[model samples]
Target: MVVLMRRRLVWALAFVLVLSLTGQEDTAKKPARTISIVAERFFFSPSKIKVKEGETVEFVLTSDDTDHGFHVPAAGIDVAIPPSGKGEARVRFTAIKKGNFRFECSRACGAGHNLMRGEIIVR
Candidate 1:
């Protein structure tokens, strides 16, 4: 009877351990995020994104015509948008600073290369 009780205790402990580990893994996984942004000849359709002070933003930037690049200086993100193609990018940051940050395409697209700009407003 004593040996049987010991074995049951061990199994219970093992089950608890497995449950704890599995719960942790689920919490660690990030939430699903999908944000669509339009990229035109020389600008981002939304032009600006408004986000809470601390939030993870998944930006899906797509080009309407030609290929372009998306760059955010403060967030340190650079993504290239293919012509008639779509791309995905993510940025996670705490809006420690409350202001408007600039985002532009690093790549030279055309005559309007200097006009490719966007903004990220954190409040």
Candidate 2:
């Protein structure tokens, strides 16, 4: 009877260990993120963003004036927001590289199009 009880206890501990490891893996698969950003004629709101290495970022981009573009070359994020204060564009990417990557306006809006730039810092 004692041997049977010991076997059951070992199985219970093994099950708990498996559950704990699986829970950790689930958490690792989900990345932490921040809020949204607004792109206008001359600038981007909250022009700088930061995220942890190997984590994902959720970007909600909207334009106030006309159609605009958001491009992050290093992270492979390119999106176009509609014109006339219309719908927004949502882009998601993983920050695997630890550096400062500049995101800019890929479409020409006005004289200040080149000045519309933002940066993402991954730690």
Candidate 3:
């Protein structure tokens, strides 16, 4: 009976530890908010983004067809989305500079690769 009680106690302790760690992770890495961006043949839908200083934005990106990329050199963010798929990448920065930053696809897709660009304004 003593061995059985000890086993139960150990399991209870493990469960509590797992719960606490999960809660901490949830709070620590939570994004300030989420923004959705769509990539098509040659453009990003909602081609312009605006955010405040110190705001952490999670970008949910999807491709209309084939594959495309989202890259912001100034912010050092580059992510690729599978065609018409759901996934997210995050950017967390204190907007030390306030202006227009141009982001483009670092990956070559087709004839419009060079023209695939967008802007982010940080205020």
TM-score of 3: 0.68
Residue 33 displacement in candidate 1 (angstroms):
4.3
What TM-score should be assigned to candidate 2?
0.71
Model 1 misses residue 29 by how many Å? 8.0
lDDT for model 2, on a 0 to 1 scale? 0.74
Give the TM-score of each candidate.
0.66, 0.71, 0.68
lDDT per residue (tens digit) for residues 10-107 in model 2: 64564455445434544455546645888888888989888888887667777888878888888555676655445566566677779999999988
Please identify which of the two predictions, 1 or 2, would achieve the higher TM-score against the true structure: 2
1-123, model 3: which lDDT tens digit per residue? 999678556645644554454345355555678788888889988899897865656666677876677788886656555555433333343355778889887668899989999888888
- lDDT against true structure, model 1: 0.66
Measured by lDDT, the strongest candidate is 2
* C-alpha RMSD between model 3 and the true structure: 12.3
Candidate 3 accuracy as lDDT: 0.68
Q: Model 3 Cα displacement at 94 (Å)?
A: 4.9
Ranking by TM-score: 2, 3, 1
Clashing pairs in 2: none
Give the runs in model 3 whose Cα sits over 4 Å from its true position. 1-29, 86-94
